[model samples]
Target chain A: MNMVVCVKQVIDPEAPPASFKINQSDNTVVPPSGIPPVLSPFDENAIEAALQIKDAQGGKITAVSLGINLLRDVVKKPLSMGADDLILLEDEAFVNGDSLSTAYALAMAIKKIGEYDIIFCGRQAADWDAGQVGSGIAEILGLPCVTLAKKIDITNGKARIERVTADGYEVIEVSLPALITVSNEFGEPRYPTIKGIMAAKRKQPIVWKAADIESESSKLGATGRRTKLLKLFQPVREGECEIIEGESPEEAAVNLALKLREAKVI
Target chain B: MADYKGVMVYGESTDGKLAAITTELLGCGRKLADDLGQELYAVILGSDINGLAQEAIAFGADKVFTVDDPLLKDYQSDSYTPVMEKVVKEVMPEIILLGQTSLGRDLAPRLAFRLDTAVSMDCIDLSIDPESKLMLQTRSVYGGNAQATFTSESSPQIATVRAKTMSSMERDDSRKGEIITIEAGLDPSAIRTKVLEKVIEEVEGIKIEDAEVVVAGGRGIGSEEGFKQLGELAKILNGAVGASRPPCDNGWISDSSQVGLTGKIVSPNVYIAVAVSGASQHMSGCSGSKNIIAINRDPDANIFKASHYGVVGDWKKILPAFTSKVKELLDK
Candidate 1:
């Protein structure tokens, strides 16, 4: 089976966040300092899943991504993680495409690259946290898709899966050529091996553009995406906390309990 | 322009059972549905989910629209999105709602994408104009830095709501609703991704989301051993130990123990934030708490504003006393 995994580069979660002042005049986020970027946390789960399936099923894994020059690093990281090929759709024009647009680009790329049995992505990229891209791809491709998946198994040509739901969980099974966004527990992300790293150093990814992918420039970027970030400043907080006074540690503990009981937790 | 007159609710569950927010959204959905006279409809996706549809009515749904199939079972992006898109195309719902949990977070944007609509996620409050039926989704922006009102102009506008933001409806066994089963006619072959396993965190007792009392800690606990201090506080009080996004991000706490927008949006009756500075990102997740008590040496800490009660002091110095007091009260 052939598979495609989409990955994105994002600001490292550990990086210190810089505050943004809303541009009241424009109602937009005054861009903050760009922090060190890395592969989104969820994307790592996809890489892990792809590697596992490749190991078990003997299929080729294609690493697909859209970004800037940093695509080199992002593409290599997946190669190191065990993807057999890489397809990078990087350019300034592709930046800021909302889920619909992103999926459109991905679908175009998938079509350009021929057929595949499945597509994988992170549950949601840590940076955007929109969690929409994978499903958008599914919709555009008209494929079956599932998000927040913790478990996925490919046996006897069909895929069996498990995903987290609001109330509890579910066990599901489906045929492939599906798009799946992965959760952290989907599998343990693999570490780069010396051989794989060396192998990636010699490999170059195919980079596609909006024109190359045959997407109309109108539906290619801002025009294709639906939502707009009118404003991005942080929201205000409410209320002043009252410090409950207690006579001793034990007293404080008792006061705390009273607070809980008073609040109806117990 | 079309009138945004109707109220809509997204009915979803994890283990093939209805979630508390489904009831709450339904209860709230009913109120809005009643105000608009357009009717309250709950949307559910996944196969074999008909078994769980009854509870939606008990929470007050006039109708239930369900798309059931084996492909819909585990929430694949491929299978679920079209089903939702089909509903939006068929009903032209003025508004759509979902729980702000993991599933909700993943699905909401995808639905918004299919509808080619705008989305406001992690919202705490939702209000609709009685006459216009326009929905103003209220959510925390800039990491809880501010509270903002959001509106959508396109078709089937969507929003994902925080858990505990609305009260779950009381169950009424006598209630019932009309059921509409939609085939969605989704092709099984197009789905590319699949789930392989299910690993529940296996936590015991009430989840932090459902907890009535929460004992939270920040950096002031001072040591890895300090978590044991927080754990003691949690143990004596029969509550969960949570941390600000900072501590959890800093590797001082487990990711599951994280409390913030990306972590878990929770509201307990009483929330005690110890040694926490109350960053907006962390504070937004706690907006639902009935009462908040902040403890810190910084008198001007950000947490104080969002907290209902506070003690200005060292948490280490204050924690033992707080524990003893609670023990003493329980002993009494």
Candidate 2:
């Protein structure tokens, strides 16, 4: 069996405030730089979900990715962590496209590579937090797709999937050739090993483009997008902070509570 | 002006069952669709999913897009996106909506991308412009320290709304709607990522994200034991419990319990905040809540600004009153 897990690079969420740059013209965050990059925390969950499937079914797991940073370093993390193959969707055109473009690029590359039993994608991208790539890829390929999956099981050669619903859970059974969006609860991501890291340093990453996957240009870029940013301005902050002055913990607590009741927060 | 066909809500599903967010979205979507003089259309996709389509209409949809294909038995990203994309192209829906649950977070953006539409995530409120019927999407940005309202001029103006942010309407069994069938053209070789296995993690089960009511703790909880009181309150409410960053960082609660930009974003119907000092990161997570009751010792706690009700007193005293009130209401 074969499985492919998708991973993307994200800025360390805990980085110092100064690490990020904002383009004054727009409220959009300038992609963080000089900050250490790691596998998206959610992608780690996706990879972990894939690893569990590979471990149980005994298959070669391939890690597919798209980005502009050091491809080798990013590719090596998965290789070291246990992925059998790594494909990098590296190219300028694939980089800036929103969720649809990113997903198309990934699907295009995955199609070029060959056949696989299943594919896994993070529930959402941390930086953009748009969470659309997996479904976008599913749309492009016209396959069965499930999102927000909390658990996945394969029995008697069919996939038994459970996803979170509003009140409880929605359970479904699916066959092979499906796309799944992994939840943060899918599994705890694994860390790389010393030996795996050493071996990963020597592995190679295959790169692909939007053209490689067979998509039209108009549908691949900005034209394909229907949403427009009418205004991107920093949010206006109103109402200054109010201070409740008091002495003694009990008095302070009481004073706070009194004020809270007045504020209707109690 | 082209015919304002009204708005559409992408009622989400899993397996053959409907998700809570889907119902909630339909209820809210119904209001918007009605106001716009357009019929509410709820879309559900998955194999054998039509059995669950009735709930959409019960909540308020005028019509449903039902696709039951063997190929759609399981969720595949590549296969489903195209089906939805194709349907939207044919329907030319004015506004498309989804719940900001895990599924919505994943699929809405992809649908937006496929349709080349713009999307606003984690919206707390939705309203239709009386004049244009353009969706007025309200959401908290910059970690919930602030809130913004927007409108989409783009086709299929898309927005992923948060669950529990709006009260779900009572189900009307007498309501009626039509179910339209859809065919997803798919094949074996088309799906690249195959499912060899799926392993559900052993994390603490459904949390605030899925809870109807949530009791949240903040810094003023002081210590781990401070949050212990929340457990009693949560149990009584039959709701989940959550905390701010300080408590989690202080190890008062598990990291999973933290609510902020770094943690899970939740929007329950009733959010009870205790001893929390609301920072932007922490506020963002809780802001989506529908009915907020702030309970803090501090009069100036950031939570009070947006809370619907205020209790300015020791949680030790205020919580007991609140819980007892709920118990009384339940007994009646």
Candidate 3:
């Protein structure tokens, strides 16, 4: 078996909300002070999904990422977690693309790699939350796609996937050479072992530029975006909370319930 | 240029009736269509869906298109995307709206890509720009820390709206509309995916998404025993129980009970958050509640910022008293 996982680097979403800032001029996030960028949380789940398959069935996993100035430690985290190879499509030309451009680059990269039975991606990136790139890649590559998968099991030549839905889950089966976008319900990703980290540090990433994929310059990065961002801002929080007071904690609880009743909020 | 004219909604239904999001899309679509001085159209695809066309019209659509086929009975990217692609190409509507649901999340992007267009996912609000006549799409980004609005120049501008953010118009059975039928034209061999079974992890009471009241706890809730207390409070209030990511991650509750950015988005009438140190990620799910009441030991917990009423106290001491008092008042 062969597998490919797509991952991305993003500002730490767990940072205190107060630390979040946007550069109004560019509508881009200003990395919070003292907090380092981490791999987008869901992408780790995607890698875990691939790793789980590799654990059950002997297979090689290749992790692919596209971005400019990706930190070595952040991008290599997948390799540290047991991925066999790391491929980076790093170039200034790849910056600020929407789902179309981003997925196009990845699809092209996968086409160039040429030997894969399955591809996995995070349900959505923590930064944009668009949740479109996986499906875009599947459509561009003309592969069967499943989104919001919690588990994947391979049998014969097909993959049985537990797909999460609004109410619960559905068991869906698709043939090999499919794309799956993993959701967080898959479970916590494993921490890299010390020995694994050492191995990762020794591994060199294969870098691909715009020309390497043979993609048209007009359809590669920001130039390929089909949508335009109009504005980005935080909506102001308006109301001040009225605190219910009492000497005893139990008394405050009683008073809080009384307050809810009086305000007709209960 | 292709003549892209009206606003269209890709409506959904289950158990023989329209989904709530479908009506809401029609309600919103009605306005956009009227603003453009065009008709509002709805397209529903499924087996035995001829009866739903009338319901779509009652909701606000001026025309309903039905593609009745067993292949579409279960939504698969292979079957539904191509059918939608064909319908969209033929109709050439200026705008398309879909619910941000399992089907929408899977279908919208593929349909958009197949049509050589783009789509905005999980939009909370959408409107047409007066100047550009473009659909202005606004959605939460960065774990709900901020919002970004986007627009596109592509024909049939597409967006998937988050559930419950838009209002549904009153159903008027007297409303009149036209219904058109389209052949499914599906080849069974093309669909590579097969749905084996649907398992519903039925929660014992009112669903959190539909509950008027939601009683949610976070990491501060110590164990499954703590969730039992929340369940009691939810029972008393005729509501549902929810938890932040930690409790669900810790196995204190099921993942379905998790409420946050990655969890379920719930917009209820009253939200009582207990022992929750509200992270922005968690707040994204419940921030739409009409009134928020918080109880936490730390007055500085981020939950207080979003609460309409708050109490600084230990939930272990506070929750029991609070639940009993509310029960007493309600029983009277």
User: Quick one: best lDDT, which candidate?
Assistant: 3
* Residue-by-residue lDDT tens digits, candidate 2, B1-332: 26436578886665556777778788788788778778888888776675677988888888888777887665555566678887787677788888776556656766776665668787778898778667888765544433556676567778988656776778887988898887776665656444433444233434667787788998888887878778776776678889987786567776567676646678888787888766666766776677676777777666777676656667776666556555554455
lDDT of 1 by residue, B1-332 (tens): 36444567888775668877788888777766676667888888877886667878788887888887877766655567678888767766677888887667777876786666767777777777555466767766545554566566576768888777777778886897888887878887655555554455644556787777788888676665787787787777678878875565456666577777667777887788888887665776776788887878887777787777667777777777777767776777
TM-score (C-alpha) between model 2 and the true structure: 0.68
- What's the true lDDT of residue B332 in model 3? 86
Candidate closest to the true structure, highest DockQ: 3
lDDT of 3 at B258: 86
Best by TM-score: 3
Candidate 2 lDDT, tens digit per residue, A32-151? Answer: 666667777778778878888888888888888887664477556888888888887666666656556667677877787678777888877666555667777776766566776768
* Candidate 1: Cα lDDT at B167: 79
Interface RMSD of each: 4.8, 7.1, 1.0
- Residue B238 lDDT in model 3? 97
Q: What are the models' TM-scores?
A: 0.75, 0.68, 0.98
lDDT of 1 at A58: 87
CAPRI tier for the interface of model 3:
high
